[model samples]
Target: MTLVNNPSRTARAGVPRQARAGRPPRLSGRRLAPYLFILPAVVLFAVFKLYPIGWSFVLSLFKTVGGVDTFVGGENYSRLLQDPLFWTALKNTAIILVVQVPVMLALATGLAVAFDSTLLKGRSVFRLGFFLPMVTGLVAYGIVFSVLLNEEHGLVNWALSLVGVDHVPWLTDPLWAKVSLGIALTWHYTGYNAVILLARLQTIPRELYDAASVDGAGAWGAFRHVTLPGLRPAILLTTVLSTIGTLQIFDEPYVLTRGGPDNATLTIGVYLYQNAFVFFDFGYASAIAYALAVLIGILGLIQFRVLGDKK
Candidate 1:
């Protein structure tokens, strides 16, 4: 018998030499399905989010006059530096950030602790009630608050009068307007923060608390030693989020106070809205927007450094 080796016969009967040699196989439709599935989302994000962001930066470099855009380099940003209204708006936002965030977070932390307590009853009902404010429409809540906080005929003032307390000017005086805005903001967002903190609280090991109890730590001591340490990350997360939201506050101040009482409540976001929509200064508005973004970025970095885990 003659022994014959045929490459063609082997090729027809077995895997290709390249595949057998460990070369990667061509990707089939099944392998490419995920990318195809996400293609529409990628395209939409580019069109809606990425494009606007890029164009807004470009728009900031050009001054819009009489419906025509003229390149002005960094003049808009320079003008922002000189703009007193912008400074005032920044100041107001700082006040809110300083006052509102801590108060809201403190309240949220307390509420979270309360909700996490085994002694508390109707936990689900309370949680849902608290969370309902978060779902309420911004405009609707703002409108409701405007009515409730009105100085002359509002329910709050009426109650104050009945208690023989003077009717506080909730939204009229400059200082009082900021207070009212803070109150509204805290009421609207504290629940949301509480819910987040509660979720974080639930993840903490119950053994730690039991150990602390065995060590004769009281409720306050246990919370100080164990609960707070466990809650650090969640508190930091809430603080950063609250900072961003407070800095960019618009709808609440806009609808409730219209950044009124001599621009006392004018936040950066409201200022940006005014520049873009009210005055039609698209270039300056874009500049303000970017400046606000930079401010947020700086503050976020600072917060992470100050509050993030050391290790």
Candidate 2:
């Protein structure tokens, strides 16, 4: 005799045979294990990040004077619009972004390619030297650059003097101060971008370049058709990261130039700090913070749409 298990019979019984046969039950906690593991991180983010941002908005609605606060609707934002110093800060920051980002990324891409090349010698030592600026203290970096860019005694001006050019005022003149700030930004971030691009470069298979060469493509063609397309994502990443940092730049301008030479290097972040800590105008500072956030968000979206890998 042959025995058959019928689902119809099991349906009539109102429970599957496996359930009736004393199969072990799954604990609810076991099902929730993953959520439990991430709960702490979620709570911390909500408390520290989300709460502070929300509070800043609330603070922006109030008028604060000498450590006292009174309700004042939209006054801080109104004041931000009329502030000339804020406008100056914004203009200086835009100049830095326009000039520094492209130059830094170009140098970074070149360094990445050089490091990845088999013909390059002392590659490890070169990488270490490139990376040394990043891990060092930001204030220390600013101080060293300040001394090295001084008008008369600086090594940079001395080097130029050797070529029959007179000493250039790196921090004393308005135009040169902005230019010097751009140079400092480029030097600080080029290696960081190089490391990121190099990591991306390593992942690209060599077969693509080989195929390009076989197709009679020369060095420039190989880079254009193969390397650039593959590096698109990394370029976008570094660009967006650099944009955010540039928009929020403070320590370098503050330490090196003190936003001086007639406010040539006062960025939004440095100005925001000045409003909050220096002037003690918490309400206006909060409004400035919000404005900076909105600007960053808009620029970030533009970069994504323009440079995204889809087309």
Candidate 3:
């Protein structure tokens, strides 16, 4: 007996009619649905994010004169090299970055460990109390801190007087102004970092800890061998984020000190805002912005190199 294969049967058996005919199959609505759903997001990103970034780079290369933009090539960047105020702002920013990031992350790590402990009572309440500061508005918190740290008649100074100690200049003296900014930053973001670390901590397997215990490891040994390795990614994440945030710090210094006490707290971000909005020197502002972006990128790379997983 002779058997013949039917085209319809072949097409129905997981072979497309288009494929059999040597033509590409058309994309069905199901396949196209994801792209269609994401199209709006893609369009929004291009218009709002990408377009503005590209325009800013172009704007950096041009100088505005008589309400018209004139192309000046790399002059704005060159000017930044010689600008005394720019260097001062950069120095202040560097100080904050060097001092604040480590202190905040260290505090956050300790908080995370405490929050993760089974022996801790009322964990939820304690966690919420610590995390509440993250939800507070930046300006609101800054203003509150400014009021509390006021040189005369502030609650802090009033309390200090009761203790027979002199009123510490929290936001007035240049050094104290930076210290005050650091304190505000630590309060605001330590909880945020702690939450990130806690989440990562939960993801670590209990079996690993038990195994370490069975192997005669103490709490510190388990933490050093198991916990630290497990927490590397989260630690790196918090470090990078803290570094970036400190580098671009603005609202705190702006509302608290206004980059004051002789420009002690003037960050690159505040200086950029001053150039853009105050001086209306958009070109210089854009240059400052791009310079900041480059600095952030470099620091990010250095962090990755130092902290990223090798295996």
- Candidate that scores best on TM-score: 3
User: Candidate 2: deviation at residue 282, Å?
Assistant: 1.0
- Model 2 — TM-score against the truth? 0.89
TM-score of each: 0.92, 0.89, 0.93
Q: How far is 160's C-alpha from truth in model 3 (Å)?
A: 1.3
Give me the displacement of residue 236 in model 2, in angstroms. Answer: 0.6
Q: What C-alpha lDDT does candidate 1 achieve relative to the native structure?
A: 0.93
Give the Cα lDDT of each candidate: 0.93, 0.91, 0.94
**Cα-based RMSD of candidate 3:** 2.3
**Mind giving the per-residue lDDT tens digits that candidate 3 earns over 144-193?**
99999998978999999998989999999999999999999999999999
Better of 1 and 2 by TM-score: 1
The list of candidate 1 runs beyond 4 A from truth reads 1-26
Q: For model 2, how big is the CA root-mean-square deviation?
A: 3.6
lDDT of 1 by residue, 131-184 (tens): 899999999999999999999989999999998999899899999998899889
In the predicted model 1, the residue pairs found to clash are none
Give residue 279's error in model 1 in angstroms. 0.6
What are the runs in model 2 whose C-alpha is more than 4 Å off? 1-27
